[model samples]
Target chain A: MEEGDRLHLGSATLRSRLIHGTGKFPSAELLAQAIAASEAEMITLAVRRLHLDGDRRSELEGLDLSRYHLLPNTAGARSAEEAIRLAHLARAAGLSDFIKVEVVGHEATLLPDPLATFEATSRLVAEGYTVLPYTSDDVALALRLAEAGAAAVMPGAAPIGSTLGVLNPHNIRLIIQECPVPVIVDAGLGSPSDALRVMEWGAAGVLVNTGIARAKDPVGMARAFAAAVEVGRLAHRAGLAGESGEARHGYGASSPTAGLPVG
Target chain B: MTVGDLEVEAALGPEQLRTRLRASRLYVVTDDLTPLEKLPDLVQAAVAGGADLVQLRRKREPWAELVELARSLQEICRRGGGIFLVNDHVDLALAAQADGVHLGQGDVAVQEARERLGDRPLIGLSTHTPDQALKAQLLPLDYIAAGPVRATPTKPDSVEVGFQQVTAAALVSRVPVVAIGGLDEGASAIEAGADLVAVVRAVCAAPDPRLAASKLRQEAAAATPWRWIRLNGEPRKSPPGETVLELLARLGVEPAGVAVEVDGRIVPRERLAAELVSEGSALEVVHFVGGG
Candidate 1:
């Protein structure tokens, strides 16, 4: 696989261009059906301390995990210490290497704390886990996380779940340019066009959950998102039309009427 | 039985009327006392700007002239895909088969109007005091207009009810109460919890009625779901498979002040729904991102 083309997580090489997260489904059965229909290679699962009695299982007890590489997230953690503790608990729950580190500072916006995120990433990386820190679109913060041994730096395009579409494209582009680790544009996505936009910005992969899970038809939206992600990735690799100011005789090469005589 | 029959009745309550007017961008006041000849153009202008509800307030005109003016406004509203409401004129409302009628205290009695118009046409009543509001509830009212909230030039003779009356009416009334009279700015009236806002000269005389109406809608959205995400990480349940955009639409959350995040990543708001939701993943919804 080419350097810019491949999306890798530790040893796993996912074939599907899209990643899926399971939330907002009406029922577990519906969620499973939606996931199966999406044909996504990787899926995210949230892990927290179980409150149930001995050997208690999750609602996803009946789900078949054999096909999916469960990427457990430390979603509820707010501080670096809390995230590190949750990461350890996730490992105890058999989600050791693949940990989605989410350290939120504010309760309302759920904005990832960049400071806590890098701190947790550094600690986790030193502890020998493949850490993926969810941070903001701050290019400097993303670079710092990469240096902290984060396998991937997931920078948000907008606040989590606003679905406003990519609010800052330039920052994401800069992060992809300066960071050595793979850049995954995550969060604030509302539509397929947004997924395509980030991929066109040269993100290694795009991870989505709410946009699909919250749709009126999760399965159909999944298919639409898959197509968008593929088109965006392909267009990125094909080389896109660079944004230029003076309308360069841009249409001359592509338009048949360019060579034809005009009155 | 048809959508129109249900809609005509449904547009009675503030909630129902606001939902119906979701696509309408116009703001017009028939009470302007603009001559019948000039009224059609003004109504058309508001409609052109997307005003879907035009009320014919004929306080200055006598009964005969008011009825004649209503028929003309009704024609304009028809072309505009809007509702023509007669302010304080049950007889003209019945004559026009107007989408509904809005009545003040001295107009026709609520029971008499309902008998004349039947259960189909929407009926809205104006209440200035809490006692009047409580009495309105006993009568069959689709919605209540609480105000004269601020002092405005539209009704120079009308008393200013202040924000307290509006809030009292909202708290006491069983039906949806729209704050009327002088709702010039968004912060005060909306923060007071008025369901649908009604402005006369403020909206009608504005340079751009569409933008004026949009500003009110923005205000209403801001005041609602005030705390978008309440407390720690408890996911505000969005219906499964809705794009954050679609979810917002379903929840009646305005397009602004809401964001979508998936898999610990901020999916550009555009791509959130373009990608599908994986089963059993966490989805967080936040609203009212801006302002004090």
Candidate 2:
């Protein structure tokens, strides 16, 4: 990455373009190792109601949570109200005011409800929370979310944990082009290549949860994703060559034809 | 609930509550005139219609009944993002886990309420005269309610302190002035320098309480005394008594990874709570934004 090429998200300047999620990992030790390997400055964590039994030490225990900027997500929320309530609960729990609004509309697909996400974003934004709404690859909705004061617009490449990878690149590209805020490609990414593809398409960053955590070698996959993110960001900033529909041979010969005797 | 519990639950600290009060335009005061069974729906409708503050004022109701009603109303206000206060009852406010208690002249002293409620809940005092309004400024109050802008049956014995008193109170008092009583439409009161307009019959007795509250809110908002300031290089009118922190909160912009400059001077993060945004003040707020 170029000097000063930091990911800025609502008062948080992050150096890493890869944001890792601490879910689906087999063990807390591995989760911590994967997090370290990923080098993600911001890690997303789901905020749920604490058990009444006072068992506060969940999988998040034994991990140095303070190391990364905690991005608490309303993952289990099925409506705008639930998402708003969860966001408040997260803030009340002393987590950062940065919230990743994910109002799951579909139980089977686990897809975010665009309207609910927008509602939560607008409400949370009005309440001084740095809102990042996880929405579908809907260009118009992404633009709307950005207009509603989302710190960043996270458009899902596909369903959460589906690993389909960039289902509608055209829509994602449109969102990135039209959105006033940074477009972060979140969810449904299978491999490091998917992360690279989105970053190369000028996405601000990529969030990998199941893609990395569920991998056979979670730590290795995290490292691979991290490297891909960095290189892709660098490539985007450096600019890529334009493509042509058809190859035009000898338009401007690379081998000097004028000086060659065979010419 | 204790103040600490309320803070954790509502996530609204005293400063945030004060900010909410300052920004409030329509305040709906519930009366015993409405049927007890329909009170929740009425309060909900009023809140949905943009009532920024809802005060439960049941003069004749028993303590037990009042507590139950207060708790329900508090939930409505909490969900609607409105401040819930109990009239003349600090204990009830505490019992209901209300945002605060609005004290009348005959009620508990402002200092006493503050001591009992602590610093978390807001304490608003109602003043009848200009002198009272001026004197109330020295007391520990979050907001000052002025007037019976016109006479009403709700408080038949109290003097009808007109719009002039609102102006007087607004001018003399440091905190936000709430113009109350006989106010159906609050444009005039807001124009008279009242930050918020509190109504009882205007909303509670309306056929459509939501519409009434909405209209009242609109009128007050239209005539609100705004302090013109340049925020992030754009000309904007902010509510009075808006500190830098309050401004940030109102805009939903957190202080983290952000820089605020007022009138060309960089305001440190710690001073944001103290730095007041005065009229014509040029404020430049820059926040980072790029996250996955």
Chain A TM-score by candidate, in order: 0.89, 0.93
Fnat, model by model in order, equals: 0.00, 0.01
**B134 in model 1: Cα distance from truth in Å?**
49
TM-score per candidate, chains pooled:
0.45, 0.47
lDDT of 1: 0.69
lDDT of 2: 0.82
Q: Encode model 1's per-residue lDDT on B188-253: one tens digit a residue.
A: 654564555677775566776556655655655555311112111432222234354554454454
> Per-residue lDDT of B169-227 in model 2, one digit per residue for the tens?
76555678889989888788887778889999999999999999999898888874857
Candidate 2 lDDT score at position B266? 60
Find the candidate with the highest lDDT and give its number. 2
Model 1, residue B158: distance off in Å is 77
Best by DockQ: 2
Task: Report DockQ per prediction, comma-separated.
Answer: 0.01, 0.02
Model 1 ranges off by over 4 Å: A1-5, A51-57, A243-253, A256-259, B1-292
